[model samples]
Target: MLFGSDPGQAEFDEFVRSRAQALSRTAYLLTGDAHLAEDLLQQALLSAAKAWHRIEGHPEPYVRRILYTQNISWWRRRRFAETPLDAHEATTAAPETGDRDLRLSLEQALAQLTLKQRTILVLRYFEDLTEAQTADMLGLHVGTVKSTGRKALDRLRALAPHLEELIND
Candidate 1:
């Protein structure tokens, strides 16, 4: 029989299929590289699978913790390399176009941040978690989440001033 045919494994498979896109989005925001983000998500899923039996109810929180912590661990080992900006893309004009340019700009901006800072932003903003929830997920004090989130936003403003306007408007 296939592994997923077992009831427990079936549930795990369903969870992965349903949440994979969201997980990949968060991973991409964290790593700023599609390939690396995909790998990160795959690794997190494997890690979660190992503990699937012990995990009761929703496994998303457990998996997300693995994703954030594992990336933090990986970032400690290697330095981040920013993608070279094409000369044309360097000039940030008023975005008269769709979200693609803004997204690219945001992606570039996100890449400039330290791993922990980016992870905090992703958790608080992108993941739509409360400060307290984010703190619990990262094993940080609630104040740390608030402070780090503030610093991360400040850094983002410095990195991508264009995005600030979007926030205001």
Candidate 2:
């Protein structure tokens, strides 16, 4: 119903509610700022709502495409003003365990990545999207997604060697 009075609105709303947490997590990873993530999520939801009538069989892909496009647009508009979280700010939240520290380190390392690289990583890891899915969502070639993912992983490894251990565990 929240998706509008279209035939697929109920199903779409169910899908949105089910995927909201995971999508928010991916958005947080993409933007690194909670506020921006919220904004991105809202924008994506609005766009998805508008298209719900036409996105019956594959709403997930439609919503993901909107989210990715909106994220890239947001990045382009804010590219100049964007800045990485400072070390102090990054560590401000007390980690519950070594694993959390590892996660924080990875987040910090993610902040160092170019926006595109960060986006690719978020789509790949946080969203659990395959390379082809990511490429489709981002309107890029599969090879580009693969290469970007490789480079992003390399940068993460270089920045936080501990992440490998954390990931493995």
Candidate 3:
């Protein structure tokens, strides 16, 4: 069990069952790739399980810290260099609806963002964390959080201008 006795194991399992999907979605936001997100979530959960004894009372923060910090570490070590299909190959794939196309465009735009900008956007908007909370989580000043969030949003807008219609809708 986490940071405690046998009772803590039950609590930890319950927490995982209830929050796994939500946490996975957060991980997906941090990492654009669904496969990587699953791996990231699994690793974070294993790390949390190991420290259950110490973080028994509050495991969420510890797990989230692992998710964020380790994601950065992994990206740094691996250059995020994914190969792209040529236009001919891409267009030859199964046709998608407008909604799917829009989602893909947004995802591509998100991928284009710098790590800092992408992280800030995901932490602030996708995770619905306050600037203060994001600042604390990322170990940045609140001012830095605000500025980065603003800049990230601006860049996202510039990258996917067509999303404005969907946003309004």
Error of 2 at 59 (Å): 2.4
Best by TM-score: 1
Off by over 4 Å in 1: 1-5, 79-96, 165-169
Whole-model Cα lDDT per candidate? 0.79, 0.75, 0.75
lDDT of candidate 2 over 121-164, digit per residue (tens): 87887778898888987888999988978887876666666567
Cα TM-score per model: 0.80, 0.74, 0.72
Task: Supply the TM-score for candidate 2.
Answer: 0.74
lDDT of 3 by residue, 1-169 (tens): 3445577689789889988988897788788779989999999998888877788566787888889887777766664664333333322233256987977876776776666667778887777788898888878899998887787677666666667664321
Candidate 2 regions exceeding 4 Å error are 1-13, 80-96, 166-169
Lowest lDDT block of 10, candidate 2: 86-95
Candidate 3: count the clashes.
6
Residue 120 displacement (Å), model 2: 1.1
For candidate 1, the 10 contiguous residues with the lowest summed lDDT are: 79-88
Model 3 ranges with Cα > 4 A deviation? 1-7, 56-58, 76-102, 165-169
Better candidate number, 1 or 3, judged by lDDT: 1
Query: Which of candidates 1 and 2 reaches a greater TM-score?
Result: 1
